[model samples]
Target chain A: MASQTRQWLLTNPPVADIKLSGDDATFSLVTKELPPVGPNQALVKTLYLSNDPAQRTWIQKDQDPERLYLPPVQKDTPMKAFGICEVVQSEAENLKKGDLVLTEANWTEYSVQDAAALRPVQPDPEHGIKPTHFLGSLGFTGMTAYWGLVDVVRTTASDTVVVSGAAGATGSMVVQIAKHLVGCKRIIGIAGSDEKCRWVESLGADTCINYKSKSFKEDLIKATEGYVEVYYDNVGGEILDLMLTRMKRHGRIAACGAISNYNNGNEKQISNWNEVIFNRIEIRGLIVLDAMPKMGEIMETLSKGVKDGKIKMTEESETIVKSKFEDIPSTWMMLFQGGNQGKLITQLV
Target chain B: MASQTRQWLLTNPPVADIKLSGDDATFSLVTKELPPVGPNQALVKTLYLSNDPAQRTWIQKDQDPERLYLPPVQKDTPMKAFGICEVVQSEAENLKKGDLVLTEANWTEYSVQDAAALRPVQPDPEHGIKPTHFLGSLGFTGMTAYWGLVDVVRTTASDTVVVSGAAGATGSMVVQIAKHLVGCKRIIGIAGSDEKCRWVESLGADTCINYKSKSFKEDLIKATEGYVEVYYDNVGGEILDLMLTRMKRHGRIAACGAISNYNNGNEKQISNWNEVIFNRIEIRGLIVLDAMPKMGEIMETLSKGVKDGKIKMTEESETIVKSKFEDIPSTWMMLFQGGNQGKLITQLV
Candidate 1:
């Protein structure tokens, strides 16, 4: 029997606030017939979709095409999504039918993508890592934390690191790597809720501050003992400003993401450049693509770490909100409000 | 007859505003008998004193003593000053009487310092470098410009550069070095007045913006043609914010000084961290001492550049407000208000 495919297209991009009722005109759901796989192509059935803060920036309008590191999402196009998939049919020599893979299949039930775009995700059954773990702990999010902390900031065991968005996917891994793997002297986590703070502490953070609380500033000063040597910033805004105030001389900041300001047209004003100058801080914007060439070695090390119990990842057991394929838009919106914990993903059969 | 030494002490530190009338009690003048030079010490007569923006930071009442790269100024001690001097008495084999030197000699007519602290300033008469030029373009100020532009920022001829405080001592040298010596594609200067702008243009800046002008923002946007690859900032405040808006991806900034926000307790808030993140800008604070190990090679190159007419310095014929030894307080006050130009100094004979 011929296969049927379903896809969602961004009809109207969200400008101010993101809505996710499935009734909103933000996305249009449509059913269609699956096309045949051509030469060097594979028919991929989406399994697990990944949602990230960068999605907000990819939808921003009036961007300088030259400045944007990623291509902007266009209206009427299938919104881009990264996910784990199962190859249903293939006309390529490198991939065979029934092979598990990772690729950008968009918000689609089934996608006919070039075989070159898919990465084989054959997890060692002996190691007991789920295929979806390939999308979270062993994928781009894990690499983001690795390259940011180890390659970019070059954090040392003696350094005190402050991780903003500490409860989020990339930030949670950063906290663990800084504490358990890198042996940082102290790790402080800045998150939004009391529960998130507790989760961050469980990930081995020395202390976690709920930024939503009124006493966060006083608490941060007391927690870090008035000194911070490395700041792993994933949420850039006022919290980044506060971090700047207590940075030690020659402090290094790994500018990984700006999730806090991504949804508001990125107009958040930071008013602590004086501190950056006086403290001799170095804030380097991190684009994971720059570290892609070295990923094979990084992934090998990460896989070994998982087997050795050196890298303890929280995404496997906590906070992953499971949803149906039809709920992609709603699941994505949860990322903006921190409603989705761990890595936000939608599973499709 | 024994020689008497005169010096100025910070009897009452300036907390709010700096006044120089000698009656404000911020400084006290006293005369005392000169002590004999000890072994390895040289008794030097002060010539030309360098008034810098960093001096204002040294006297702050509440400073993290460990963070300060330099020792803070104490209430009863002589104010720290760098100047050209003539070694009158030398007990160390490295120095001799009447030899010209450059060293830190407080606000004093005579200073007995370790001979190792003084670097010989033997400019070949054929080079036509005046004795006072050592305090301006050949001393620490020149080294500041050299390390910041060439070593730290590593600017190339293909880059467009913007310099704030382009008419001042270190800044003017940076402008000349980027344009004339480094061969940058375009050099734009941001200064306080139209006259200073013209002076900066004459110093080889492709264009100059009078930051005090009402149309400064529009003028800056128009001048750069919507792109700036390097920013050599000396006056860090709103000007730094303006530069942030125009910086290109992977832009480099050499944070040399914050003269604009140095006085009045450095309260000027910077609101441009967002730009620093999106543009992938690297702002590095330049502490000249960190570059001291390379001084021999750098000083040699700068001296050769001056001799070969490759480094066209502007201080040869500019506003250098020279005063007597007792006028150090008043001369320093000129720096905050922009009352003096070129290099503000006290010529003590």
Candidate 2:
């Protein structure tokens, strides 16, 4: 049975002198017969997709050359992302037809992937969760928070944790995971606005400070009382420097992402590294892809937490004009402008 | 009998414009009658004093202007140091006269100190170690190596350990301890010359590289084979930069001391910190004074190792003339120039 699949492809790749604008970019949906699944592969139908800031990082032609986190996306290729899918056809042993799965599927209606890349999503009927929950809370973002706090940072109950980009998916998970699992004494969430700050506090943070406010540093210090032991940094730049000053002795900083400096061509350099010597701080940069082996452990912990009502998960939804998968480029552009929040996904059914 | 004691004092302090030379910069030996020991205090006759690079850092006016470590040496006060002392008189319950002890005794022939600051030395009859060993391998330097490797660096037996300043007192002990107790598979020692490299290899390093060689970086790469897992950094600056580039993922760097840039009025700044993020390295700065509480555990390990002949210990001795005590300023000046190896001491007997 031949099946038709539609994928959004980039055309007229941006060059060095070109600026990223609608006039210079195009998104096209190509309809083709679905390819046969290999011996250890499955055919998955896309359900919910994740639009992340990391995607914008790769879309820019002139991103920071010093970015050690993600590799630069090649020209004119299908963009990569995590999406919730249903296994429509399968040749693999573990996955059967109609099995809900999560995988690094392309920005397409249908994807045929190796069984190694696909994780079977066992639906939890008891938690009253949706398939979208697998794309947000029980997904890459949640796992990133778990590994960054537990494995990389080694945060303890006595620690005071401060997280940047606190309203976003990974940052939100970081705040909750640190508070609930690690039993962090104090959690100060730094977000762009007061509404996000309030939302972060709703997730059980001790305090939440608006980074957009003029008194962000003062507020952070007041909230943490000059005792920040673990800094889960998602947005770097001046905020990073500010947090470094307030770090206690033997503090651990997990440099998860530098979203503030990601779009800028030049990287921000820390001026006072002598403080690193004086305070004896340990700073580490991490990538979730590098943390893939611990996926099983992270899932077990997060699933239990979700079931016990310890980890509260939420998503922000935005309705955008949908075309035949050809409007993904425009949808992604809106995301970069902060037009969407939480998990940005387009409904295909 | 009341004893008459003489001690060297920094009589004139260095102001911003004042040169460290000439009559204004004076060291005076004052003959004074000893004061009576109070309860919980002991009068000790200083035997061997330990002169370290960190002492120079304490004298600088600009280094940590707030005096995070300790206040700058006051004019006309006895210089501070760690020394092996013989108890002349004791009013404390734990100590008695004729007992050899180790304490933070000043650079003097005789001084009074609290018994709480002193640890009674138990002579190990099997090893036949000297009293000076308490100031070197079995004392502060030895304990420094123990904590930095085990606790700070968290070295494992499978690690490939690299020690910078490997021929120095603490560095030598670090090499031996990592090789014997930690059971490191490969130990590479970096020293100043071929002779020092040979000395490090003799002390049980699998390989040793001369940092002074023109092709030192190439030699280091060839020697270690790009497999440095734990770097015990005693000398920072360019050597540190070199080590950072080759560090394996999750490598631990024990920033024990930066002897290379310690006395540079303008300290050298590290440029290639991107390697820190790229390799996901953890660099921890350490002070041996902070490791004092673990003295008992450290001694237990060292005593057993020394008794079993698993640890080889050596001390570098450079003796200054007794009259040169007045030239204390110049004597300390020589240390910044790397004029002495192992330990530099002034003889008064």
Candidate 3:
């Protein structure tokens, strides 16, 4: 193993105008010697880094440190991320050298993580599922989609579902699950561009509407004529407002994220508060951590679905925007800009 | 039997400035001959009419006709209200003459309603609980409080419950139940005035804050030091927004009414929506009709509680704003103006 390890450290928080300069003060790439793995810990080499919008929220300077859902990434510390990793050295019985695992070990070429914090990736060659699926489809994002749809929104085949941020990592899983697995008759995806909309349509969504198009409202209204029963909201703000207007009585909204408000000082506001009350809608703000107790069962079902070919997970590596370790700072910005089509993966090795 | 009957009719819908003029175009008092009872129907006399905030929402001229929870009162027709009534004549086996009952019959001195729609009142002379308990503590408002608090908010003894519109009919019941029955650790009531705040305190709330006071924010913070675990919201607006800030992680909000939005074109927008996401809050909009299937059992439990003296319902009839039959139009206005203390009732007979 190399004696020197390189990691991206959060230096300063990003402002409203979130752009990375060549020598961006927000993040710094530094090389240091790998720390010795202690007992119950393993040294991991990150294979694929997962890019999530939640990364932006974690680095907010003004957020109350005590109230954050998870601890914020401290200044001059390696930013926390979920990634597919290979155990390079181990002192724990659960993990061994060359064993692939999923962990909060990324933005780094090498990491020393507690073995207990890692989840082993189940290799199912019969299904042709890659180990990276554990970072996206069969992982936290999939767990979020499953619980949000089945448990929170209580989706049924008879219902018409609407999903915002439909081409993104988490939202795309929700769109496919609602359509194919849950058997929802009509699944509509609201995305930003026609290219993203096309990607969502290719994943078996009934229809995709580009929210940026001039005919967005008309197209959405025409597409969801029966009204939305379940709205899996990955992007909140105006898209959520539009969905609120088109919701039927007793509609359920799974508030997954408000990516639109992440970098903007002027947070997107939802004005259709009346529709929620008048229609007796239930809006639940979900954090995947709340669904952790059901992880074992969730992973089992997800694995079976992938193996049985009941769940369609895009495996074309070309879809995952690959970047070198040095490009981590600029590449992370792609999450906010919607420049990354599928999951954005940074390959270290 | 009396051949003539006096009833209140809705003449026109109210405007942004919702006021009932003495001879208001919104309501008319008319004398009409009682219609004959049909099969499975009973001719009932309205003993006490319920003046609920929902009445204001039901009569909104701009509301979609199909979206009303219950059928809206037609122009020149008897305004619908819940009431404690006496069955004067019945063609149905379940109802008989002189049977004290609960009904969706009000504003009118007499109504011909389906027997199935009436819930017979349980008179407990032993506990000195009157049949009027059916309209307040044992009625739809009571059911709304019960389900909203117990079922929806899932209050526990460990919870710090805060209620808005604390002295209003439905809110008072919620305040009492969350404090007394559920035994929440800290119970705070948010009311509009000191007098209303005092009334809420008398019902065993740990503290009461007058939202109209300049020290409202400081007082609320001091009262709920541990933060609000469950918020039963009856008046939605700035008060709702204020509560959003003080909510703990996984806090539940039972949205029973948004009375503040009824009169103004400006609907209350919750600006601290990020708190909901970060704290993982769940806000459920409730309409009592959704709990109809649990009505029989809900009324039974409430009636028994009143009879057993386990539930303390303030029976100072003076606190109940009672008006003569012709004052129905003016009496309804008392609801919006916070003119009623315990419950607003119109005595038609």
> What TM-score, over all chains together, does every model reach?
0.84, 0.75, 0.84
Say which candidate scores most in DockQ.
Answer: 3
Q: What is the C-alpha lDDT profile of model 1 across B1-349, one tens digit per residue?
A: 2278888987776765765655667778899888878999989988778788788777756655655667878887888888888888889998988999988878898878898898888766676677767777777788989899988889999999999888887888888888888999999998888988888888889998988899999999999786888999998877887787788888889888887666545363555455666667777877888778998898888888888887664454234556787777887777777655566677764
> What would the per-residue lDDT of candidate 2 be over residues B148-230, giving only the tens digit for each residue?
99988889998999999887778888988999999998999998878778878888899889888999989988877756789
Q: What is the Cα-based lDDT of residue A319 in candidate 2?
A: 28
- Report fnat for all candidates as fractions from 0 to 1: 0.32, 0.27, 0.44
The DockQ ranking, best first, is: 3, 1, 2
Q: What is the lDDT of residue A88 in candidate 3?
A: 92
TM-score of chain B of 3: 0.91
Native-to-model Cα distance after best TM-score fit, residue A134 in candidate 2, in Å: 2.7
DockQ: the better of candidates 2 and 3: 3
DockQ of all predictions against the true structure, Cα-based: 0.30, 0.19, 0.34
Give the range where candidate 1 chain B is weakest over 10 consecutive residues by summed lDDT. Answer: B313-322
In the range A156-249, model 3's lDDT, one tens digit per residue, is: 9998889988888788888878877888988999888998898888887889999999999999989988677888988777787778888888
lDDT of 1: 0.80
Residue A215 of model 1: what lDDT?
Answer: 98
